[model samples]
Target: MSNKKPILAITMGDPAGIGPEIAVKAFSDSAVYNLCRPLLIGSAAIMSRIVKELNSRLKVNSINNVTEAGFQFGEIDVFNLEIHNPEDIKYGQISSTAGDIAFRSVVKAIELAKNGEVDGTVTNPINKKAINNAGHHFSGHTEIYAHYTNTPKYAMLLADEKLKVIHVSTHVSLRKACDLVQKERILDVVQILNEGLKKLGINSPRIGVAGLNPHAGDEGLFGDEEIKEIIPAVKEANERGFIVEGPIPPDTLYALAAGGKFDGCVAMYHDQGHIPFKLMGFVWDDDIGKMKSVKGVNITLGLPIIRTSVDHGTAFEIAGKGIASPEALLYAINYAVKLYNN
Candidate 1:
């Protein structure tokens, strides 16, 4: 294993959103500098403008490759793609220009990682509609990565302090999510969740699988997914020497997981996992009319390269406010460091 500090490439997500703001904000933290040698895979001019508008004291240094990055505190290095003009993008508005820039940055970061130029990637939020408008048809980061890497099996893992949840199906409708609750898929999710948790430093993870129906199907009264699918999946995982408990009631499973009853939870769908994880990570300060802190990392497991991102979205309403929280981005960088070291 390389003992040198890991080099991380951060993709500046939709320039029109909070991506630029938070990227600048996160670099302002000295801790980030100490954790990894970070580079921005976006525009230097736009980042400079954001630094000046936000009145941040950081300096933007444009470089052609990772070797040129200063990786020094108070100075940020950007691998400028020069894909979009700052004047072409409007803050908080969805446009094809912003979409193109965002999509290109991600592609650049992935290329750098695949070529071994960077250790991993830490992405900010990008607008799905805008990306689609730009002609890159994909649901979310996980799909884009899977496509680029030619990976068929991948899952979204949202991690905070005590609560860790992995989605069996994400970026799909509730009806489609239910339709995806097959025994093979459930078993795959369990294996992926367990391996992902272990990568995050958990040894011998105890996974809790949630039931697809009310009260775990009430023993076939409401549904039998538990008996027919979920239970069998859990049994197979256990027989393979995994410490897993599941087909539990969704209502109580999350509560117990949050309290540290389990190392990780396998949610049946997107909302089943996101709502609980967001409830714990997102804090709203009504008095201040902004988030107190956004504190979760969205990690894509079973990818060819390491990828971690902020669990929040593009808060278009607060794009250039300079108050967007970088807590989540910071955590993501730290998590990437952990994974690299492991």
Candidate 2:
């Protein structure tokens, strides 16, 4: 793994969504080949269909194992998971079978990394309801990876260029998220984000922690979560010799981060981190009624094996149109390579 190309197990997210299409689009760039050998971990039949649907000339090379992948730029080496009649799961339609296929691919990717078969993993989007309908019962990929890898101290970190963010709690109700924001939880996420920043090449990272309440509790006028929960965490981090800042108003923290004022931000909850970060990454075009572009990469910090994903959703309305943006996937790959190198 030293001074050589790494092999990345790229899960072809739910076939019913734009995962397959965006993956194909990302690989078409060819420059990605110089970074790592990408092994597609999903249905070969579906990859072949996506290739044809996008009018791509690349051949789909179905393989039985990771070593079987040629990893050639002009060819897509699919670690083919033969699902039952994959053709039955049409594009843009949710099905339990599709969810099962997506879940299995991720499971295999984790195995490959744990067994030292691959360097890291880049995941595509999977539908939560579809996965639960398949009986997986996980909120999202972050939870799935944490469960499989036995990583209890994990946080979701979203990175787009210079703007990096981690949530104190994610995949929970807003009320629960508020209640969960104790000093211990904040400290845990702060530590995770600190390590994550270093892995991304930010030495001596300056971190900004967002307040759970408006205006960071407005000096206890809005809420006590900041005074009771957040400030103590920030104090502990400073005492621990980490460059930490905050109970900054959540509204203003992201703007300061976007302006390069801090190395990363600690979001108190999911939407607190996600809303502004997505605003930085996802651009909607009102005139066309579609996304003009999509950006940002989601990294699960505190896992033994590296996992990165596109920040966007399944985009069911535009699944097979061959128009979905692969920008985020490319960023995810770049970040995976960066983490794997470290």
Per-candidate alpha-carbon RMSD to the true structure: 1.1, 1.1
TM-score of each: 0.98, 0.98
Write the residue-wise lDDT of candidate 1 on 144-219 in tens digits: 8999989999999999888999989999999998889988998898888888888888889999999999998999
Give Cα-based local distance difference scores for all models: 0.90, 0.91
If candidate 1 were superposed on the true structure by all CA atoms, what would the RMSD be?
A: 1.1
lDDT of 2 by residue, 288-332 (tens): 889997889999999999899999888999988778888889999
Candidate 1 Cα deviation (angstroms), residue 262: 0.5
* C-alpha root-mean-square deviation, candidate 2: 1.1
Q: What is candidate 1's TM-score against the reference?
A: 0.98
